[model samples]
Target: MIHIYLCEDNNRQLTRWKSVVEKYLLMNSTESQLYCTANSPDELLEIRKKSTVTGLYFLDIDLQSEKNGIELAQEIRKYDPRGYIVFVTTHSEMAVLTFQYKVEAMDFIVKDEIETLPDRICACIKNAEVKYKTQLDSSSRLLSVKVDKTSLILDQDDIVAITTCEDYHKIMIHTKHGVRQMSGSLKELIAVLNPAFCQCSRSAIVNMKHVVKYSREEALLTMDNKETYSVSIRMLGKIQRALKQL
Candidate 1:
């Protein structure tokens, strides 16, 4: 389920947006729920920590506090990297700041267009719900690996590749965020992973979902993130078949 959050400072605007969101929720039967509403970034962040699932956030750019919407979004990303963030603010000029902040806001909604505010908000919710459902469905399977003292539970879809490290006893997990070194064997890890993972070589197992292009001549597989991995000649046929299934 996609939890929804709203953060607006002004009482009137807050009430208006809350009303619109509540009405939309009542009228439509979706997996999205109006989770929380806050008058301050602190309040929102406080509650955001409790959410274990992805969220859809509608934030006012100027929150009249030290942490504005963009900054709050940066903080939110640390916890919910795959969540949707939509900025609803009167200051349309602040839209450019989202790019500088690297928040990847789904949309910048201007409150000046009062007539369209409700529609835009609902639209963002609708679009986010569709995307959230897709991710939730694909993420039913999880991979748990120990990174140092911490155990990280990851969505199988997020893993780009897993390769044996130089130490042989340790493996390197290549994800979109970064690489993580963990103690494990490729054969052992493959036993726990889904069918989407294919061992391209003795040292590396690549997620078929992340395989962008494969060159049989070069015996290389290019990932969606542009990282390349070599495939053993014996595994070329298996890799080709797996990619075709994707």
Candidate 2:
């Protein structure tokens, strides 16, 4: 389901835009389930921190607060890098400012051209949905591990186990060539992967797809590679539940 967030401060404008968006969605039979409205950057940040959003944002470039919509978009990118951002503004010149945020904004709808705004927004939403789906299909979760000065993309399925060595976490991948060493933090790596990957222990996050069998009593995970890894007692139930879903 798509989760749309509208951050417009003007009550009348907000109502008009909301109606436009809702009408477009209904006409197209869009599968948007959650719609959040915020008047300020602070409110947007709060909603972003608490919610798992997966759709377009119709943000006002000029807000009534200290921080503007561009600043809020930068903050949103930190957590949700894939969300579609669009600027709704009175000043068309502000379009260049989007490059500073490094956000691939779908479009900038000029408030003066409010008559055409609904059609423009509808097109952007459809485009964003297509791009989002394509990304999900083409990309598997990659754990980037820095080996010396170079970084490599380690597929989650290729990982056998993780072990920490001093400050860095060593990732062991069962490649067609052999096992290889790549460095990263287990905590940071987990954030990029799907939540379905459960931590067997402090050092290892066994991919749910690779787990062939799990022992709750011993807190152990046996992968499809026939290698066994120990899970901490605290994570036993999580591992068991993840394995069951397979």
Candidate 3:
């Protein structure tokens, strides 16, 4: 689901942009939940505070409020760093201010050339999805695992490798002092992780961040600790692509 926010002061332009965005979403077979705010930066900020946005934003520079769209964008970034922001304005000169908010702003669009605006917004949303997934995976949550009747809350990031054993899997995690082992099945353990941690073999689903080297010919993954695990030939390409993104 994509949540889009539009901040435009002009009634005519706001309606037109909303129509264009709706058409684009319909054509792409995607559902968009849109929040429209006209000329009010305070209302826009309030909407953001109440919503969990996952998509792009179309903001107008010449807002009716004292704070322009650029200033509101900086404020938005404080809470939602992953949302895509596109500034829309009649004044092309305001494009220079993009440098100040480039970290949050994905692109700037001229109001007259609104024909090309939908494509840019769609592209930015796609890019944001990829980045959002990466960020979510990098910040894996802690989980408690029971091994031989002993329960432990393991830091997911400390996990170096995981391998299946009969009906269970052995998880090798690196602590500040040394490595420790926990028991669980690949399927059971994998459900707790994001897509970034992919299965490289029938017996193993390794953390992409822990992978330091890989050999397609040898069908193996070498972790930062110098331990090598066998990678199935069929899953090698998938593992390689995932690692390359890192």
Candidate 4:
């Protein structure tokens, strides 16, 4: 189920959004709920931390607080990168600010058009449902590995690099969140990974999607997260070909 949150300072507007969202979800039989509502950025952020699943957020661009809507959305991304954000505001002209903030908002709903607010919010929810479902369909993107008696299921996109650890039988899986060590070999892990990963070196296999820049002369690769990894000369041609596919 998807969690829906709303942040609006105006009490009347807040109530209206809550009512419309709830009614729409009930009428359409959507597997979602109006989880929480807040009147300030801080309050909403506090509520956001408790969300266990990807959420749909409706934020007012001009919140009467220290941080406005766009700023709040920026903070939200730090915790929930894949969550959907929709800006519901009276400042229609401020739509361009979402781009400047690089928040990747799902939609911008102008509150001044009161008649259309319900429809717009419902549309955003529908889009979020589709995107979230697509993300959950991880048949080709999931990396499942076993460690001891436990099974670890990881999303391949969250993985940054998989390399052989100092231990002969242990491999380290570097992810956006942190690192994990499992008793295995890079060769075994690579066999299960998708083509988006490239064996850049004998010791390291980097996710090509996260690689930012590659220097053949230097034999180095920089990832989107600013981590650097060595690329073996033999794998340079393979890396180049894989990058082209990206």
Q: lDDT: which candidate is best?
A: 1
Pairs that collide in candidate 1 are none
Ranking of models by lDDT: 1, 4, 2, 3
Q: What are the C-alpha RMSDs, in order, of all predicted structures? A: 13.5, 14.4, 14.8, 11.0
Over 4 Å off, model 1: 140-246
Index of the highest-TM-score prediction:
2
Better model by lDDT: candidate 2 vs candidate 3: 2
Question: TM-score, each model?
Answer: 0.57, 0.58, 0.52, 0.57
- Candidate 2: list runs displaced more than 4 Å: 140-246
lDDT of 1 by residue, 138-239 (tens): 756556677666655566776899999889799998977567788989999999898889999999999998988888789899998799999998898898
- What's the lDDT for residue 240 in model 4? 84
**Which consecutive 10 residues in model 3 have the weakest lDDT in total?**
168-177
Across residues 1-246, which tens digit of lDDT does each residue of candidate 3 receive?
346888888888788777777776565533245655555778778878876545467888889789888888888887677778888888789887878556457777787776777676666655654555455446664455675575554445556767755444465544322565667567887788656588888777787878888787887888877778887878878887897799
How does model 1 fare in lDDT? Answer: 0.87
Clashes of each: 0, 0, 1, 0
Query: What CA RMSD would candidate 4 show?
Result: 11.0
Q: Evaluate model 4: give its TM-score.
A: 0.57
TM-score of 3: 0.52
List candidate 4 segments past 4 Å from native. Answer: 139-246
How far off is model 1, as Cα RMSD? 13.5
